[model samples]
Target: MVVKSHKIHDVEMVEALKEARQKIFTEIRKVIIGQDQVIEELLISLLARGHCLLIGVPGLAKTLLISTLAKVLRLKFNRIQFTPDLMPSDITGTEIIEDDHSTGKKVFKFVKGPVFANIVLADEINRTPPKTQAALLQAMQEHEVTAAGTTYKLKEPFFVLATQNPIEQEGTYPLPEAQLDRFMFNLWVDYPSEQEEIQIVQYTTSAYSGQPQVVLDAEDITAFQDLVRRVPVATNVVDFAVKLVRMTRPNFDQSPKFVKDWIAWGAGPRASQYLILGAKTRCILDGRPTPEIEDIRAVAKPVLRHRLVTNFNAEAEGVDTIEIIERLLEKV
Candidate 1:
């Protein structure tokens, strides 16, 4: 009964957010030319309090989109450029000795790093070594950073929006599967259309500037995130999510043949959890009270893409991750 009351209250918030979504899109359009899908997924991930990973090449405005989002949402933003030589301390701050003027003695001080922000853009995350990448694991999962035996809570509404260059692998270290599973969405930022490209060139060649209005603040975002959790979902919708995740595993008894042939390792329980959360957020953004199977379908690709690891058979048959996921979706 208490859950029913929370859902009723959240419905009002969801209704109001319907307009905010349009306002946010309008504000973002000032600077961005296209990639509406990417923006929407990013918002879903942020509002659900989940981390996101974007796979794109250089010059795709991945950085601009995130920075513009931070501006529109009025959140603190930071960017860390990952490189081969980057160290863990660089991403998570290290302890330093300081002279205490009050006591005339030496003291240890922990200067926060770029990770101590509301929105963190981890640029070229794959370029760094595993050790450096591991620094983000705790922060992404726990929303807190532990250094020198002390754990510091990160700011509210915190999320790590990481980007990768898919075209480059010469010096890049692929993210460990453990780290990959931490992200709720693995979005692809494709090349812009011809018309969009022309518009992008036109905008950049001139003094045209786009300043998106501040849509929501930290408090509103935190409340909405709580509301997303409060939204109700049907039992069948939950079952579909769980079943979709299970079918990805090659060893499951009722798994699809293509999955057994192509997939090396399937997604775990986390995938199911994200599917529901993402679906809930999607319906709310569209002003719906509860999610349906179709809502789960819409979020399946991004949620499952990075989770499924293809095997040799998949490679020989020329079946990619997206194709495997699509075929599985067809069966359901």
Candidate 2:
């Protein structure tokens, strides 16, 4: 196959970006034994400048994967353990009155919280109340925070990798569809294989210790993100993505019969945009100059999982949103 070359400003820069991405992936694998697909999708989300929601049972190493990726990329990392009683001010900093000794006057200062980091691990996000969860809306959408009538921009290359427990719902507040729409991908982390499980047990039982190496600096990561945006997509591939998203809406005339009955809402335009950007990132990681249709298909589940909303009937029937997505893909 004759792959078309990327229209990067400097051709050599692409080579450097490829090397940096590979090195970071290598370092991440040192600590994370399995779930290579999850890691790759997470990387695609990062490069596409979108947030991710990781859903799985506990002890799947979701936190370890995000933290290790932060370490390998040499980015500031912070973890926020969400709880039902958590308040908005807890995640986004609060204003406190302080007495200035030098000026002899009182002033309100905003103390930064974990949300200001380059990489944030929102552990058990569903445990937090909706009020507290709203604190991340501005940061994820605008890359800025508004507190006490002041807007503070977050650091560049900011990425939120939030994890939620799928099995527990006792004290968990289900994420509102509006908030869930903010995420680019809803990655499902599953248990390891027999061989991988054996390796995990052995590695944990042993006393082996190794620190994560810094494979790429912040500048390089930002550059690669920009490159992902610039990657070219053919008209046909773009149309394919658009059609896939449109078919998810139950109200749409062209939607599949199952989707029309089961889905309450379909994915919006952002889904198509993220789908293209994610495919571009996936292609780059796979050493391809341009994205292919298979790349879009590979990422469809993660990209649309959270975006599509199912009706109560679908839920009562124990049908998943992914099944509706698959039906749409087949029709499209």
Candidate 3:
């Protein structure tokens, strides 16, 4: 791990956050039985000022995870249960006519939707149509909402943690790749282990008095995000991340044989950006001052998985993005 040797800014803040990580986990564990990796990735995206898309089947506690995390961070939380009838205005909000107190005249006022909060959980996001789904695109990318030709800035440390059901498709409108690209990390929430499931059942069936305490606020999160951006990475590590992202594109001459054979499309520059951001945050969360090439590789899968489009050969051969990414890691 080659890290540029230098004095990191806000050393005290980084050290405080590093120590607070265990406390945050302890609070989250009160409600969440397991899924440590999922929690870590969510925090990485949060601290990096990026959004995430969680793909998992129902009953995996996806909703609970984000909500619990919001509690742990002490951030304002909102949840929207996306459905077929959900409209774009239901997300970005709508303007209403109201009487003006000063002028005694009817005036239009914009009402903030669930998107105005610090952490918004787009539950069952794919259940909504593309038109409704695209409502979040701007807010996720620009941290602002437009209503009736007026733009309103979202609160600081804003994040949209969206969840999608991978098993159900009958009535679900799949999210387009363009919208998917807005997410920094496409995290997979897997099922709990047997023992963990047993613990979950017992815990839920019993008193279930678990409660998570707050660890940080909006301002604190914003400061840490700034700190993560300031973390130094060796130039070679950055080149490695760029090379890994470039290798995903099958048409590029530099891509490997397997990538060309199986992948029809590749990740764009945003993937590279997220790779570095996520890596830096992960490094800092572990009490390190700098990120390395291995940090880039560690964040590679979540950063690239949703951005990839496999060809027919891949589907026929049953090669998913996970396998493709694993091979890409080895190739890189």
Candidate 4:
């Protein structure tokens, strides 16, 4: 048997890539019982080339979802269990001393850590100290790591799927607003339904163990990303996305009355960028040639939730960011 590589420029290749994504999703469904919405949001973030912050109670299968996605995509996956004692060097690589026996000379060699993988699962991220969490900021934004005065480029399609337990606050260092802004989406995972829970238990206890099937490779994913970027958006759609982000700020004149009283800070330009990119990716996934206002509205919450800040009065009143966002959306 012989295998040949197909050129991406061929029209048939695009169809094949779409088929590959379908198969990838199907394979992921094998191990993952439910949380279809969570899976779709993760896929959008991946296609947008952006990171995600997943917040849910323990035992929601957040880690499993990320691992299953990485498995089907045939990408390298690494899980980092964030802890208070974890150091920045533990996530990023560090310089090590090495000796050249022939010349009897010692030199420093850079040892890469778990961050070198294509998909990184930052589990219980809030448990880690601030300094350790900061190590991921540059990589998530720039797709590269700088160490020992040398910059190393990460592989294409790099994604960081970070998970945090929302109920556990004690002994946990909450992520600062600045670092939270780096994520494109702040997804909230909910518990599975009774039927889904039964299926999960059956799948685990049955003899038919679910195994991930590789449906797409690195090159195919890169091509899909290019296609996602090519998805078109109308002028009004772009303006809607921009206005939606600007209206989140309390200080902005266009902001709603609720926003002015409840929100202490508004989203920045990055939120607008994420909103547009997220809509573009959603359109591509839905097989649409162009983005729509509906697509932007669907993704606005995840993109803007972390960017908006609540005032002390709002906190005292038991008002959350989501409520303020809903009001802004209604007014805008």
Clashing residue pairs, backbone N/CA/C < 3 A, model 2:
none
Per-model RMSD to reference = 2.9, 3.6, 3.6, 2.5
Judging by lDDT against the true structure, name the best candidate: 1
RMSD of 2: 3.6
How high is the CA lDDT of each candidate model? 0.91, 0.85, 0.88, 0.85
lDDT of 4 by residue, 1-332 (tens): 01123444433444555566578678988889889888889988988888999999998888888888988888899999999999898998999999988889998889998999999999999999888888987788888888989999989889999999888799999989989999999999998999999988888788877888888777667777777776678999999999999888777887878888888889999999999999988876776667898999899889988898889989999999888878777776
Q: Which 10 residues in a row give candidate 2 its minimum summed lDDT?
A: 1-10
What's the residue-level lDDT of 152 in candidate 2? Answer: 94
Q: In terms of TM-score, how similar is model 1 to the real structure?
A: 0.97
Question: Residue 167 of model 2: what lDDT?
Answer: 87
TM-score of each: 0.97, 0.93, 0.95, 0.93
Over 1-332, each residue of candidate 2 has an lDDT whose tens digit, in order, gives 11123444534555666676677777887888989889888889998899999999999988888889988888899999998788888878889999999999999989988899999888998888777888876688889899988999899899998888888889788888888888999999999999999989988889966577988767777878877877888888898899899889877888878888888888899999989998988888766778888888988999999998889989999999888878777777
lDDT of 2 at 42: 86
lDDT of 1: 0.91
Model 3, span 1-332: residue lDDT tens: 11222444467666877887888899999999999999999999999999999999889888888889988888889999999999999998888999999999999988888899999999999889888888887789888888877789998989999998888889998888888899999999998999999999999899878878888777678778878888888898889999999999988999999899999999999999999999999988998888888899889989999999999999999999999999989988
Instruction: Find the 10 residues in a row with the least total lDDT in model 4.
Output: 1-10
**Deviating ranges (above 4 Å) for candidate 1:** 1-8
